[model samples]
Target: MGLPKRDQQYHTYADYLGWPESVRYELLDGVAFMMAGSDLAHQDIVGEVFAQLRNALQGKPCRPFVAPFDVRLPKPRQSDEQTDTVVQPDVMVVCDPAKIDRRGIRGAPDLIVEVLSPSTAGHDQVLKRRAYERAGVQEFWLVHPTDRVVTIYTLGQDGYGKPEIQELVGTTPVGVLENVEITWDELVARLPKIEY
Candidate 1:
């Protein structure tokens, strides 16, 4: 199915909190973006990665959260219902306790992960990259299940810096998150083969 049309109006996290769960969306630069669902392989990949991150983060100060969790970016002086924009990142880690809110995360997360699908590949690479950068997210990971590759992008002064691509040939270190590493083979083993 296609995404919802642009409403030509900007919204905040509070506005999104009132939205129905049927409408999947992400807010970027004051615009609402409908996030498309992914295929089985895509979801499996994300689940595997999320599981790994969760297991590894045990005992650490960081906490891992899966999608469908609202991540709100609030505009200045805006009420929760007025300027709060809620997004569901595939995976995220919140290191700061203060940013956690009853509505969701109100600021940039320590790490954000997006599993790429055909329709969203470009948006994740470019559009979402810019948005996450502008939001000051420390790390972003783009997972391409078809290619059996994962690209880790860390936030830099200008924007998201060059990505480190790890092919599914062997163990690949996730350089962005400290003390965390995973292999392409490990990630690939979690998903069924793509028939197409």
Candidate 2:
């Protein structure tokens, strides 16, 4: 039904970068994993959230970016032989211009968002969440299409403590971002829908 799990090895960001545009991938624990692509519904959800962030942050210091963008968080041990992992989040908000490199966003992004798909559920909810928190990402949002809701994780000095889960039924109160407030109803209703 699906590909078997293998111990995929990667050397550097260059190695991962050399991959063709046909596939999406990520490096975890110094290993390369082939992640499945998202369906139409997932893309729609991501686009909706992306639009909200874009609209809200307009004329503001913060800028929103969609992925296929690489984010590299350096580790303590710096050796040429050591593999540096690079990740492409579904969406991200970066307030720091220094982190925005020619290649991709390089340091801690203010907000990281992942639109969940069946194949990436475990990684998004667990591994990536832990990594983003460890990197000092201020916020993390995971949008689920099937459940029709979004869960947000905010980082604290201690750690990524917990998430503020919001159930989106018809209309709900979305969180405040960069001093701007938007409702869940407006987001869902205005989200660009795919024409069948």
Candidate 3:
């Protein structure tokens, strides 16, 4: 019912530029994957995380970004035409202003937060996680709305070490942002309750 599989060729940033502006997609290793729409719970978590990061980054050099903001991850010395990875993280923080441009972020953000959705859980947890680690993202947070938990990964000399797990019932400081703390209870309180 859609385009032929044969026509679905490996895509690059140049090809990404030609897609319909209304739809959202991510290019991972030259393969284009359509992005799924976010549910209310997913959006709520993203908003809360973004708000917390935005508040903490006020007056600081680092800035926070929400989804639909393209993050082009190009390999060393590769041109945009030769590069092929692009992702729109649920929430991202970038300290280097030089990386921001008219198209989007040209490099990896300092921190990336992904709010899990059933359709995207695997991609976010595995493929994207490995990609972020490879891109040298300093910190990564996987927020699970259903489980009400947040798993944090911090990169070290070797790579990302074991994750720090925290439930969404207490305050936890962001590992990458100094003096930034998020009160999970407050965030949880604002979320809609699910009735079993």
Candidate 4:
């Protein structure tokens, strides 16, 4: 379902920019894929984690953001017209002020967190994972709310290396950002228990 393109044709940032704001989509390799609405659990998890990051990043250089914010990944030497890939990470932390353009992030963020769901497991784990790696996103975290676990990938000279998996509880370090971690005990308690 995640691979559902609006139409079977290549699209670009220029085309994406012209679309109505009411409807949201992301361009991957010039392919326009519709973004689905977040369910209650997904929104709750993203909200809580973002809240945590916001508090932790206070007075810090890095800033946290939730989705619907564009992250344009332009291939090397490609201009805006030639650039294709653009995505909205669920939660992102941008440390560079220059990347924080008026429209959205012009480059990769320091850290990107994606809350996974049944509808998006494959796409996030596979498609978006590769995209983030290629774009040099320093760190990528996939928060599996259902399984209560997190999988992190840190970009390296060879791109991303092996993933580091951690339980979505207690004090788990944000590897890319020093002295920052997610203490999930309180956050977990706040989340409503629901059967998927």
Estimate, for each residue in 1-196, the C-alpha lDDT of model 4 and write its tens digit: 5657789889888889889989899888888888877787788889988998999999999999999899999989877767799899899999999999888898889999999988888888988999999989999999988888899999989988899898877988888888888888876675557667
Backbone clashes in model 3, listed as residue pairs? none
Q: Which whole-number lDDT from 0 to 100 does residue 50 have in model 4?
A: 92
Q: What does candidate 2's lDDT look like per residue over 1-196, in tens digits?
A: 2322335554566666677868766765566666667778777667776787789889988888988787886566643235365678888889878888787877678888898877788878887887787778888888876676788887777887878887765543333254654356655654446432
Q: Could you estimate the TM-score for every candidate?
A: 0.86, 0.82, 0.92, 0.95
**How big is the positional error of residue 167 in model 4, measured in Å on the Cα after superposition?**
1.0
Which rank order by lDDT, best down to worst? Answer: 4, 3, 1, 2
Tens-digit lDDT string for candidate 1 (1-196)? 2345358788766566667878788876667888887788877777877788888889988888998887775556655566534568898999898988776787789888898887888777887777677778888888887887778887788777777887766655555557776545755775655563
Give the top-scoring candidate (lDDT): 4
lDDT of 3 by residue, 4-66 (tens): 121368888989888898878888888788888888888878888899889889999999999
Residue 185 displacement (Å), model 4: 1.4
Candidate rank order under TM-score? 4, 3, 1, 2
Cand. 3 Cα-lDDT: 0.86
Q: Considering lDDT, which of the candidate structures 1 and 4 is the better prediction for this target?
A: 4
Better of 2 and 3 by TM-score: 3
With a 3 Å backbone cut-off (N, CA, C), the pairs that clash in candidate 4 are none
Q: Tell me which of candidates 1 and 3 scores higher on lDDT.
A: 3
Give the total clashing residue pairs for model 2. Answer: 0
Weakest 10 consecutive residues, lDDT, candidate 4?
187-196
Q: What is the lDDT of residue 119 in candidate 4?
A: 83
